[model samples]
Target: MENLFSHPESEPEPSQQDDDALEPFIITVVVPTNVSHAFQGFTDHPHLWWPLDQESVFGEGSHVEFEENLILETAEDGRTSVWGTIDDWQPPLSFHASWYPASTPLWSTEIRVSFRAVEEGTEVRLVHDGWEGAEDPAASRASYAEGWPRVLERYVRFMGGAVA
Candidate 1:
């Protein structure tokens, strides 16, 4: 899965890779922490950092676990729902996942996040691609472009990292 998202890898930062009708939305942020810590903020501490107001498969107060191999949510009653599959699970470096949220569960999109240690701290780059799966790719991309920044802002706050 990493191989699938490693294209245009020469760019240290975010690089756009246009493929057919889909264009990847790249969001890069600098966190004031080590690579390992930043990675943990995204994976291990998702419940603490991820914005919960958005559309979710398990709804609020659900026990959500975004693991290396799978993303799942469990209700209080023990009902479980799977949202995505983590294909590449490299720690402190990168990971790739196929995301299928509740709103549009019929299809999936590719999400890749890379963590790199920098002089200031860590660089977390997120790429959300595969918009072709959406019913309205352009609209969905537009919504995410506005939403991801806010979500990352919350993550930076939770990690005590500054977005540079």
Candidate 2:
């Protein structure tokens, strides 16, 4: 899974200001399914499972969909938003994206998800990082500490389990 998170040569190297490792938060949960079911549940059927936190991402009447690994939120009024870009799309193993939640429009936050087969099911790990800027970064990071857990709870319920 480390190989999946590595960047290409063309991408700029991380700087001191772009550091997320020092203050990033992570959430790990076990879903009652195989790698494929867990990965597809997050990537393909997110609209069905993802927490409909209207204040975070999609707006009212907007639905999330994937286009060539790009996450989009389109509304009935024809307003479409770029939710995030899937940086890595290795199915049933891992996926990473530059997430632009509605609350943080200044820049994107990085989200890395990894799936591994476990004795009971698949262990899904989520790392939300790349929080730059000022105090908002810290505040945002703290806020997500609460938010991701709720989101993962939904994932667990949708996956037909209580592990998360």
Candidate 3:
């Protein structure tokens, strides 16, 4: 089967901060479905599979929001973005956004998630890069590395139930 998580030849390499600074962290987890099932549907159902520890800002008529006050707005064309109050929303098959912590120097970073179909399953690749402002890049990378697995596991389980 083809490697669904492979980056495009034109894609730029992740920025490197410093030798001691933590390198860009990328994690890919293959789900047993297509991109439509893996991203749009799975992500839209925040209530069923969102991280319990994180605060969600979703309601009957509001966009899905996160604890860091990031608002996830979906366009009519099926594009999604995590936007700040001032920034414009832009969408792509895979894109980047800022991950700002509440009390920090607004640590800027980008998270790119892509989905591709493969024979065995759908490859959900999550690449979080641009950790330039983090106090400890290594620690930051370790935390996200651990967190994505748990999040993806929950998503996979949830999707499995829907399929069954």
TM-score of each: 0.77, 0.77, 0.59
lDDT of each: 0.79, 0.78, 0.56
Q: Which parts of model 1 have CA positions greater than 4 angstroms off?
A: 1-21, 103-106
Q: How close is candidate 1 to the true structure, as a TM-score?
A: 0.77
Residue ranges of candidate 3 with Cα displaced over 4 Å: 1-21, 54-92, 101-105, 161-164
Error of 2 at 90 (Å): 1.0
- Evaluate model 1: give its lDDT: 0.79
Candidate 1 lDDT by residue in tens digits, 1-164: 46775668466753353342367899998888999999988888777766666645556777667854888766778987777889989987999888776644567787899999889789899999988877777677887788889878988888887555
What does candidate 2's lDDT look like per residue over 112-155, in tens digits? 99999999899999998877732367677777887888878888
Q: Model 1 clash pairs?
A: none
How many backbone clashes can be found in candidate 2?
A: 0
What is the model-wide C-alpha lDDT for candidate 2?
A: 0.78
Clashes of each: 0, 0, 0
Sequence-dependent TM-score of model 3 = 0.59
Q: Please identify which of the two predictions, 1 or 3, would achieve the higher lDDT against the true structure.
A: 1
